[model samples]
Target: MCERNHPMKCFLATLLVAICGLFLHPATAAEDPAALLRAADRWRVSDDSLQVETRVQVLGRDGAVEKERLYTVFVQSGHRSLVLMRSPAEAGQRVLMLGDDFWLLMPGSQRPLRITPLQKLLGDASTGDIATLSWAEDYAGTLVGEESCEGQPCWHLQLRATRAGVSYQRIELWLGKARREPLRAELYVQSDKLAKQARFVLDRPEAPTTVAEMVLRDELGTHKETRVRYLSRTPKRVPEAWMNPMFLARNPPLE
Candidate 1:
């Protein structure tokens, strides 16, 4: 696995720039794409551990809800996460991601199954969607130009994968000019086909920087959509053993 997490030193400096508007000014901000990506990474939740409830909704061509599921998510500092399905049809199904690796544990499975991040989770959401705030580590970003997103001035960032085994080979991101929050993103395959378009909804009153919901719309067909919402967020300590696939197979039920 590549270096998937930035050091705490960068986190402090980025937080300073994010909170004080020190680097918000276009002129003062670093023009390098990599630096801009680091700045963007600061907008994510960086607590030591985070627990949240996620709800995913799938909409059909006519804008009717086709399916919905709730999930409980646990995230650690080192890009490690566990997602447990809460709905009946998919209950006891869990996905664990450690660094760049992923595993899927289903009910009655003898062992945990390894999976890739590019696999579709639900609707327009991919397995990579669970960890949406990893661009700083996975991609090399370049500032393409200035654009308007959601009627607000924003920076258009073009990102290419730095290492292998990433969900999308390339991505285009838009962030608010003043706040540096992600406004929109376009995911693309290696063939340059637009796979999905995502909009970040940062409306969490408790955690202003954390994106509360992500709206993903399919680029093909009738433009089906999926919305993943973060219902609650709390900081806690997660044990390392819990992230192990062997431990996952042993522990069937999620508390």
Candidate 2:
């Protein structure tokens, strides 16, 4: 920095430097990607273990409601989750996820069918979408940048799957600038093909504490829309046995 002898010139230079400093963020204050993800995860999960009642509505290309289903998702610790089909048409069907492995059990069958994370549960939503809610646990990446999103400043992050169990191989997540609440995401499969575009709706738009719903649009041929609404969330931990595929199959339903 060069200094000028003139008092007026010196004052102007100092003022200009101060103005630039306001826009400049220090390296030490850089946001941690993991922490940002964890903060954003809270609006969705709300707890480490929770029982979330979910309603999934699949709409056709014309915006006509085609199929609606309900689910009871028991999110547990250690990357274990059990999702039960609550709709009468899909009753007694259960999907269990334990880390990278997944199994599906039919109402009448005692065997648990092995499944993949990318398998669609309904419309554009995959099984992992309902079961795995924490992006910090599944993906890792750096902060991409900041931009205007949904009429508000947003931080954009590009994340990649840390393990093979997650549904999307890569994700472009946008979060609110202030609270770090997730705004939207672009999900990509292992082949790097864009699978779906998702937008989150908050319960309270102005001051949101929880996510009310997620709207997913298919990028595939169907181009249908799927709305996953969180009907209710209760902080409850299921028994350790619920994580077992054989136990889930034999039990059929949990009381």
Candidate 3:
């Protein structure tokens, strides 16, 4: 009787240990996602002036090459951002940025066209979602859980637009655990279809803040991909007039 009861006693002890491990594992996993989201949010640059050089590639539906262009962008926070073409023939045409407003100056046209709110949303050659810089204010975020990204452990997050007029309905983000930088993001429309995808790799860490060597790809038939490289950063005061559409068209700073 004693020998038979020994196996039953050992089995009960092992079962209790397994139950405790299951409960503790979830609690441990829960902390990482929230912590990573907070870290990414806290990371920001003090400089208001940002300069970026980008190479854009457009691919056809058959995965064939379409066209390519090189672009240079300069932005002063709350003031203006200027984007200009540097390659592929139309090299000198400029896009003036005053705050949320954007203006395009054609090569032959003397007057700059003030981009309307509706025009901003429309698919324009020079102006698109990349021209907009208000994502921090437009979207709200929540940490979902942990997931692996490219074999590296990462935190998954869900972001939703606070306003109805925003482009994407939902955005899912994967941030690297060790790097504390975003690895991948998927943008979804109201219908829950993936509209766009962005991947951030090659982190150029500047101490407390790290900027992404970014690759933004639009999954639409347009097949546009923008690769942005950080060129310079400066903390300079931005003039308020630069944010106005009328001001942007009238006064474009010459480089």
Candidate 4:
């Protein structure tokens, strides 16, 4: 009777071990790829008025301090977006965004000048249809593996642009384990050179979810650092009429 019960006990133990193994697996292993893609798409700022205050620091060749400049960014989805310099030279100079067009309003100039596509290509901003939210539309994202960023465990992902006109050819993103928020990102050019890297340190997980603090460092030619801080975010829809280029240049969003 004891020998017969020994085999039954071993079988029960094996079953329990298998059940434990199932629970120990990574949560993302069972996650649907399509669902994850959709979730990433849904992660956007749906606010009527969104503001970001930032301090940009230009670094010397030795990675030491250089100069600091302050700027304010106001974004109203589909309607208008404005970035104004607050301190140092070019104070009060603003970049206005209306619909698909972009214009720069100088501190002294009364008229807003349109930003050419070639000039946009040279800028740090991501190129292509700005309104789209899907990662697949702008980049081809693939799961790299589990990694660590700033001592926290994260999922590493590699995103490459599908089209040639895009700014960066590839981007390595470090996503938070629980929140799925992007913690860090590294941009790379077609020459296999590292262009820029950004680390998001402080995050506000409240409604109209905001990234409170971020440090962006350019690594390619000249080293430049930008620190961004979110001031406020309100859930409000923007008017469609405000998205036109003519309206953007005529009535600047700065005031």
Which candidate number would show the highest TM-score if scored against the true structure?
2
Question: lDDT for each of the candidates?
Answer: 0.79, 0.89, 0.59, 0.56
For model 4, how does the per-residue alpha-carbon lDDT over 139-207 read when each residue is reduced to its tens digit?
A: 777777677887778777788877554446787877766566667889787797887787765454454
| True lDDT of residue 183, candidate 4 | 74
Worst 10 residues of 1 by lDDT: 22-31
Q: Per-residue lDDT for 14-67 in model 3, tens only?
A: 898888877866535445444555566434333446555555555555655566
Write down the TM-score for model 2: 0.89
**Residue 43 of model 3, lDDT score:** 40
Clashes counted in candidate 2 amount to 0
User: What range of 10 consecutive residues in model 4 has the weakest lDDT sum?
Assistant: 121-130
TM-score of 1: 0.81
Q: What TM-score would every model get versus the actual structure?
A: 0.81, 0.89, 0.63, 0.62
Candidate number of the best lDDT: 2
Instruction: Go through the candidates in order and give the clash count of each.
Output: 0, 0, 0, 1
Rank by lDDT, highest first: 2, 1, 3, 4
| Candidate 4 Cα deviation (angstroms), residue 46 | 6.3
Q: For residue 77, what is the lDDT in candidate 2?
A: 89
Give the residue spans of candidate 1 off by over 4 A: 1-32, 204-209
| Evaluation by TM-score, superior candidate among 1 and 3 | 1
What digit string (tens of lDDT, one per residue) describes model 2 on residues 111-176?
999999878888887899999999999899678777889899988889989999999999999999
Inter-residue clash pairs, candidate 2? none
